[model samples]
Target: MNKASRSTVYDGEVTWQRIADEVGLSRQGAKHVYNKAILKLQKNEQLKQYWVDLIIEGRATKCD
Candidate 1:
């Protein structure tokens, strides 16, 4: 979860290859873990509000 969270914190600029190497998983496996973490986060009400606040305050940024 730490590795996945760090990658997401960087706006996904970190590649799956790097995360996979660090976690001793294949690229696909790393992606799977990251996806699962995201699915869990999506269910967190506090996190949802945090994102909504960021968006409302114009502090949210996404990669093009």
Candidate 2:
């Protein structure tokens, strides 16, 4: 994930509005971009696994 996508995940559990605020986008726009990125990642097993590894290594910090 990119900076914007990471920010979305960080704030989505609380409120996507927070993500929008952080990323300078509207709430709905943030949702759209986040959903699209997730779908893309899901469709690529290798990329998904890479993301999982990064998460496990604690290197997935809001866009590392």
lDDT for model 2: 0.79
Where is model 2 more than 4 Å wrong at Cα? 1-12, 59-64
Clashes of 1: 0
Residue 8 lDDT in model 2? 42
TM-score of 1: 0.52
Error of 1 at 48 (Å): 4.7
Worst 10 residues of 2 by lDDT: 4-13
Model 2: per-residue Cα lDDT at residue 11: 36
Model 2, TM vs. native: 0.65
Error of 2 at 35 (Å): 0.3
Per residue, candidate 1 scores C-alpha lDDT tens digits across 4-40 of 6555544436888977977789999999998887777
Model 1 residue 49 lDDT score: 82
TM-score on alpha carbons, each prediction = 0.52, 0.65
Tens digit of per-residue lDDT, candidate 2, span 1-64: 3575663434335578877777788999999999999998999999899889987777456566
Q: Give the top-scoring candidate (lDDT).
A: 2
